[model samples]
Structure formats: C-alpha cells, structure tokens
Target: MSIPDTASMPMFLRAEDFSFSDEFSDLVEFSFLPGRDDMVPWVEYSGGLPPKSLWGDSICGENTITIQSDMYDFLDMGALSFVPSDETLLKILETAEHNRKCPLDDRITLGDDIPEFNTELCEYTLTIARSITETIFTRDPYTGIVQEHSPPYPDIPRFKLTANPWMVSTHAYGAAFCHRIHLPLVQRVGASIESGTLPTVFKPVFKPASFRRNNVPTLTCGTSGSDVA
Candidate 1:
C-alpha cells in the first residue's frame, strides 16, 4: 500500500503489521507487564484485514493486523525506566538546538547553568515542565544531550499517565508520549530562539518507501499467554 501524505493512523498492542481497520480503530492498549487489567474486552473485532494479515514481529489476532514499528514505536513497561531508550531523542535535540532544524548533528553543548529536577513527574505539574522538555528538543541548552551519560537520571522516553498504560494501551501511551515530547519541546523552542519563533508543533513525516501497499494484509497475531477479553 503506497502511503499518501498522511496516514489515517490508529494505535495497537502486540502489533505486527499495518491494516485497514487498525488505522481506524479508536484506541490501543499498552502495558508494561502481563496480567494488567487495562484492556477493553472485545465482543467483536472489525478491521478489513486482507487474507492472512498479521501484526508486529508476530500476529495480533485472527482478524487484525499489527501496526508496523516503522510507522510507530510500540511502548510498554520496557520503554519505561527499564527500556531507557532516549539516545535517538537526544541526538534529535542536538540537531535542532544547533542547526535550528531536525537534521543530525554533532555540535552539542550543555549549558553551564541548567535547571535541576529532583522529583517525579507526578511531584510537579508535568504539563508545565513538559514545556521544558520541549525546549530541550528545540533549544537544547545542553550541547551534549546524551542519554544516561551525565545524569542522576537517564533521558529515556516515558509518560506520566494517571494510570500505568503499556503495550496494550499503545495508543494512549504513544499519543501521550508524543504529546509530551512534541508540544513542550516545540513550545520551548519558540520561546528560546534568538530569531523569530518556530512552530511549536512537531510533525513527523514518514519516509516515502514505507507507503507501499502491494504486500499481503490479513494477520493472525497476539502475545503468548495473553488473551483479548
């Protein structure tokens, strides 16, 4: 399936590959561990999956397709403090801070007087602090914004949900995480730049080749020891 300018994107849990219905599905469950009670028990499933469609590294269900990680990064408990995957994010920040764009770059610097935090996201108004994170993305005062390299805490990707949503709540997790990094950093960039402010919104553009839709579609996939209610 050739991708258009935009994807009518939906979220997923244990996603394998993309599908028609997954694009339109309203929500996805993400959990860090098994036996978590956060999923909606499905009485009926509906995604126009082509014959033999599958999701993720494996299948998701009998009739559903797993969303491609290429298009989306599925987050679960692993992505929490455990996964610690933020190098890519920091590199992206360095690029934006130095170049005023999101291309890759090596010219990173840490500001001599950066603010400090000693509390959890729950301790503070995260939505406001998140604006600071967005600033890290756009105006990164810290030149060497390497993850876990110089920290009391690592620069990992995570969320401060009222609930512990993980792989199952992939939609909620992804959207919230996206919102966390996307909005705050962009907002900070607008306020930090010496020149005119840039757009305080992050718009990720998927590569062109990924839109190819000539492949097969219907998928049978799900995590082992897990069942859709």
Candidate 2:
C-alpha cells in the first residue's frame, strides 16, 4: 500500500539535526564492542542537551545555529592514531606537505618523519599535550585553506546515517581502518595558525541540504568508532 501524505510530517531533516531519545541511546550502547567497559554508558537524563555556548560558536559563522551530538557525552578526547595502509598514501601526503607554500614561522611539516611505530596501532602521542577545548569546533572563520593529498579517507556522506544507526556504527570500524592518518601532526601544526587548528581536526560540519523524513521523530547517532580522525 502507498503511504499517504501527512501535513504534520517534517518536510525534511538534515543529518546533523537529530534527537537523543531513550531508544536510540540504548541502540548506541549496544553497537559498541564487548570489552569497551572503559567507555561510559548512556544515561537517561531529562531536559535539553548541553548549551550551544558549551559547543562554542558555529562552524558556519556567528548568528547561524551549530548543533552537534556525540554517542558518549563523557568520552575521553585523546590523540587518534592509525598506520597508513601502504607507502603510497604516505608518499602522497609527504609530497602535498612539501608543495604547500606557507611562512616558515607558521609552517610545520612531517616530511620523512614517519613514526617508528608507523605500522602498528599507536595513539597519536602529541595530542595528549593539547587541551580538550582545542579539539572541538570554534568561532574562527575557515580561510579556504586546503592541502593536496590523495583521497586518504572515504566519503562519510551525511545521507548514510539516515539508515539504521547500527549499520553506521558497525561500518565505523571499517571506516576507522580506512581513515587512519597522523592527525597529531595536523594538531601540532594547526596550533600555530589561527584558522588551521579546528578544521584540520575531523568534524561533522553541517551544510544546507534537503531530504524526505520518516514518521517517527528519531535522531541520528553513532559510536566512537566512526571518529577515526
């Protein structure tokens, strides 16, 4: 049977806009691996989410609304590290680093300094020194700055999350493996340039888009596994 058009239905919903309901929260917990006891459990809390001021200013700019929701509110932020799949990817990044023109005072390049533990699962140790506040989005305008590198990570399209959160959480493991890069390097160098810091760090920057919605007012959510920055 064909579904009828309902006036009350939401015309559209952006992937960034989502609910933090009890049922979805439970699903988020279930999606985690068995031994992640260190990860905090989702609690049933009332009232609204942490203030907009708490997340700081919008990435889009001032006056525009910026909203973000994570699976674990109390997640410990630290350096995210992973080994390159092969020498080709590393070579591409190294070439990009050399080609980019920047003032010497503001520039920091990894060059040929591939970590000794580059092949293993190691934490990007440098991130430990940075404050948690530094990692999140902020008020600074993006200077249209970009570096040329091979497609190091897969496209984490927004529309993908509209499907079952379980699928996204599961695929996040795969994405983590695929998305691995030396983010600590980005963190250190960005700290020098005002516009470089936050944008270098991976974030779900919202954009204007349109799509149909379902009946239930459900929210999009996922596990920390997807955060393979």
Candidate 3:
C-alpha cells in the first residue's frame, strides 16, 4: 500500500481528537501487523543494527542518561572553544538563559561553586552542545544529489522555554533541532522520491536466497503470500 502524502496532514493532533474510520481499520491493522517469522527472507536486507554502547551499564539513579562529570566538562569546553559561522550556538544559549526554569539564569547569580552547576546543569548544557555540533558537522548521505539540501539549524531566537527548567530545557533544544535540521532532511528525501532522483544505493531490492533465519527453509519470492512452502 502506498503511504499518504504528509504535506496535507495537520502538524499536530491529540489522541482524543480523532479516530480511525471503520472501513480503514482493517487496512491499518494489516499494514502494521507484526512480521511473521516465515516471511523474513522476502524482505530486503539493510545494514546490521548498531551495537549497544558499552557505557549502557554505567548510567544509574533518577538521572539515568545524564552525562558523566569528566565527559560533560569535555563537551562544555568543546562547545565554547569554537564558534560556528552562524549564531546558532549563541542563540541556543540565549534561549536557555531566558528560560525561567533553566539553570543558566540561576547559575549566573549563584557563582561557579554550585553543585548543581557542576552536575545537572552541566549535563543538560553538554547534551545541547553535542546535539548542535552533530547537526553542523555530519555529512548528508545524499549530499551530491540534493544540492539545495542544507541544515536548517533551529532558529533559537524564536524558541520559548517552559516552566520545568531541566525537562523543558532538554525538550526545547531537541524540538528545535528536529524542526530545523531533521525535518528539512526528511522533506528532501521525499522530494528525491517524487522527482525520481533517489540514488541507486537507496533503491530497495530482494536479498539472496541464502539469507536464512535460525536455519529455517527460505520461502520463494513473489509467490504463495508469505507461506513457507
């Protein structure tokens, strides 16, 4: 089944706002149905999933994902050491400062000796800095094909901070990043598809017959509708 064009879809919706029509319910269910073990071979092969980080076991307590002090210090220095050609990082910092809940404003008056500044605030700041750096430095997969494609680093000037400083600071940074950077990249992908300019590397094709799951017999392609025979 073909996916609907998202350009016409609403930007946001609440769960209480809408329900699937009865006629389309079955189609939706079928579309999302979990893949059967027998049908695995019919799918195209992509690269293997990334290995889990070795540091996964280290994080603990309420701040499970918080960055370690030494790492946070390194990221902090990295963020401040180099200025981007644009004001993106400055704007990010400005947005964080204006946020009443953000630790920035508080940290400014409290001097450099505060414990939270060394810990929680430091972690949040490092996260934001690393995210922005990744956006600016990463190369596009289809860089040559999409000449117009560029990173729309989120306009931090227009960003608004929420009341809960820690949560709001992190969330706002992420939302802005996605809205500015990731969304445009996705739109570029769709444009590539529509224009039939997608690179050959991206085109999906069937995997070899030798591809097996748990030593099971592979099903024949384009026949018997996912049966094992």
Candidate 4:
C-alpha cells in the first residue's frame, strides 16, 4: 500500500475532513483475522521504523473509545492545478477561500483543548494540500498501476509510499481533536477520503507467519459529501 498523493493536500468542508507505536514493544495480540481486530496494515506499514503513529483512548458520550491510527493527509495537487471550465471557476475560487480560512473562532473543547493542534490545524491544511500535489506530480504511482476491478480512483499508487507516520497520525489526531472540539471530525474524515486521500487499511505491523492480509483500512466514500468542516 504505497502512500497516496492525498497525504499532503489542502482540504476544507462544511463539517468535513479529517497511528500507533506502542504495540511493538511489549503488548501483543495475535489473531487469524487481525483485520477484524483492525490493526495490521499499519503495523506492517511501520515495521522496522520509528513511531509514525499515535494512540489514545477516551470516553466519547458513554462508550470508552480506543484509537490507534496509521493514516495520512494526502494532497490533491491536480485539483489545485486543475483549471476548471469557465462556467465554474469562480465557485472553485470561492470554495477554496472558504475552506482555507475558516472564520469561526468559537472553539469546541475536546477531552481538553489541545494547544499544539490549535495552532497547527491551519498549517497542516496547507501541508496536506501540498502532499496532494507532490504525490500526484512527483510519485506517479497510480499512473502505471492496474485497477483490475475498475476501481473508482484513477491515480492511486500500486503500493505503500514512504513512511510518514505523522501523515496517518495527523488525521487520526485531528478526528480525536474534533471529538474534543464538538465538531463532526469523523464525518470530516469521510469527506476527506472521498475528496482528498485514498482508503486506508488497518495494516499489520508484523509480517505474518503464514499469509499476508490486506487489512489496514484506508478511508472510504460513504453517503457524505467530501470535505472537512
């Protein structure tokens, strides 16, 4: 699962957008279908590497939630460079402006206000946008790969991109942060995957003894508009 261009791109939506490192040391869990456990693609993706992931658990509403993330913020450079038809260029510019600069300062408190993220969210958007451009123009993975099933995506790469644990962590952390902020972070993620990056699997950390499972789940397109608000 190579990294996609969406890993670094700018994105904004009405209510839109959107790792791990602890498991390698002592704690361990083995399963036949680790995909059900939801922690494989990321594990394998980060093997023999430093922590590109982040994790935490908190009470959201009533259920205790456990979060382990290995995803990324891909950019959509093509979209940026894309010169829309004259009929809709103005709308594109307007939408870009709105997303790039969200005016609502009314902060929502997640478990607590994450100070670092407060300043970094805007900055990350810019970086994520760049990821899209760079991944698309520079990598060119999807250009050569064959999508046997006639997949919806056109330019996604054939395999994993370089390790950027922060890529996955950024989105995951953002969602968690959204939880604190009382924003629809989860919804934002869905929008992003549709509009920004690819679907991520819960990758396995360790090479399997018998077989390889395409587990780590990437983001997916659901019944939601693609964008992060």
Q: Candidate 3: minimum summed lDDT over ten consecutive residues — where?
A: 24-33
Error of 3 at 196 (Å): 4.8
Off by over 4 Å in 4: 1-113, 118-165, 168-205, 209-227
Error of 1 at 225 (Å): 27
Query: lDDT tens digits, residues 133-177, model 3?
Result: 332221112121111212343421111111112222222333334
Please give the clash total of every predicted structure, in order: 46, 1, 1, 66
Evaluation by lDDT, superior candidate among 1 and 2: 1
TM-score of each: 0.19, 0.18, 0.15, 0.17
The Cα error of candidate 4 at residue 115, in Å, is 2.5
**How well does model 1 score by local distance difference test?**
0.25
- lDDT values for all models: 0.25, 0.23, 0.23, 0.23
Give per-residue lDDT, candidate 1, residue 194. Answer: 25
- Between prediction 3 and prediction 4, the one with superior lDDT is 4
Error of 4 at 24 (Å): 41
Q: Model 3, residue 193: what's the lDDT? A: 19
